[model samples]
Target: MAVALDIVHDTQETYRKVLTSMSRPGTISTVIGDMDNPFPCHYATFLTILTLLDREVYFHVISDGENLSKVITDYTLAQETSIENADFIIVPNGTNEEAVIDAMQKCKVGTLEDPQNSSTWIIEQNMISVTGTITLTGPGIKHTTSLHLDITAELLEMRNRRVQEFPLGIDLIFTDPVSLACIPRTTKVSLDGGVI
Candidate 1:
């Protein structure tokens, strides 16, 4: 028999992992409990969705068919909507960097008074090296920290645009098959070779 996830327990565990990763920013966190088979997207991404999404959330999945979106909405009972309206946006591995930026650009970046409404992105990565390749600083870091990424400069620039105004920026969760890391709006990021 296939292993099953006890919805309440598993979701809570996954939620804790995500929260821990987000709170620590560049640090890696592990997802606890069993995830049977998460297709079209990495298992980590699936579990993150399962943990964070619910009936009140609006989400968008980037793909060619409705299967991925349908499955997510059905399983979570969350509504599926356009990128511009989604509370959570999942960008699968191999998606074009520009497209990811476009979708992110359309997402809600709450106003000064309601910055908490900003969208959160769960982006999948094929690899996350043992040692970080880019540097991260600001809140959550005593000095500086590093983390590996396959993200492009365009995506980095787009992210910067959203964060220009304090308290009104997107939060990102980067996940691979086994690891999860995050970049909250409060962090100041820079790639190797002094690219900020």
Candidate 2:
């Protein structure tokens, strides 16, 4: 039991480092220390699963039986739930805009007192470029920053609608094979016509 506790502690630390890196765009962080599995789970996804997954947290893998989902379940010990009942949703690719939006709509909106119980969406981008002119402002950001996420227009529209709900919406984490970025519910993203 002592060893198990130590692994959990180490995982939590890695998760914290990843979150801090995401909060500050373009910043890089390494997820080191303990790992239960030897699969190719990226540092971002591994840390996310470690920090958020548990018996109480139900997760939905948007991709249809992707290898990433299997690895995630094996490492995190989180139960798979229907889209409507999930506490966390993972999108292995951002191309499925409709499915992603539907999953987001199904997430539960916790009461005003415990709004943090709401779901978190982790979207994997096929490509990430920081050269885009899109401006993001709100919450964790002091000033606007420029970054490009490889998400479809429909997904962006859905996210915009969801963000209009303020503190009652799902937060987002966008990651690639090597890097990751975050867009909390409080963030405001506006794209400039460039390929993102």
Candidate 3:
């Protein structure tokens, strides 16, 4: 069908954008898709989900409403999994700090032998600002880069705890309405100039 072909093309394009952002680490990449939107989730979030989730993987949607569950399953056919077992986790915008904290706390960090089994977070933010207070330093960055999160300090604190140990933490991809950025576990995220 023409509709299916178009979806395939859009998803491929979104995958390229996500890949570029992931490889660059601190830099932002725009996901410009003209795909039809039917869910309550943000446009960027919808695109990210289409690119990352499928029947081969399991995902959990936290900090979002129930409507997203049906939408995600219908489109991606990815299993709706529990937080601890999710290969991918999504946190939609307008979610309270506590819910995000809870999801972060429960997400799997992977095992020693199979670190690739870890969960990846697709988080929707109100906006990924041009300038930020958080400093990032690691594999993909040249020296250090800054990112400002629109969420509360409590959520940041929780995320800080998640990535403390290498090969044993979650990876995060943050999306706004039009753009996305990645923070893989290898990157060190520090608040201000100090490591949290």
Cα-lDDT of candidate 1: 0.81
- TM-score for candidate 3, residues paired by index: 0.91
lDDT of 2: 0.67
Estimate the overall C-alpha local distance difference test score of candidate 3: 0.82
- lDDT of each residue in 1-196, candidate 1, tens digit only: 3456567886787788887878788888876435556566767777888889999999988763527788788788999898888899888888877788888778888888899888999999987653765788888788888888889767887887888798999999998876789999998877774755
- Write the candidate numbers in order of decreasing lDDT: 3, 1, 2
Instruction: Summarize candidate 3's per-residue lDDT along 1-196 as a digit string, tens digits.
Output: 1123257777888899888878878778877645455568877788789888889999888855657978899988999989999999888887776877998998899888988898999888888865988888888899998887676667777877887777788888999877899988888877778867
Best by lDDT: 3
> Using Cα atoms with residue i matched to residue i, what is each candidate's TM-score against the true structure?
0.91, 0.77, 0.91
What are the lDDT figures for the candidates, one per model? 0.81, 0.67, 0.82
Q: Residue 141 error for model 3, in Å?
A: 0.5
Question: Which regions of candidate 2 fall more than 4 Å away from where they truly are?
Answer: 1-13, 21-43, 193-196
Off by over 4 Å in 1: 1-3, 32-38, 64-66
Better of 2 and 3 by lDDT: 3
Q: CA shift at 180, candidate 1, in angstroms?
A: 1.0
Give candidate 2's error at residue 87 in angstroms: 1.0
**Total clashes for model 3:** 1
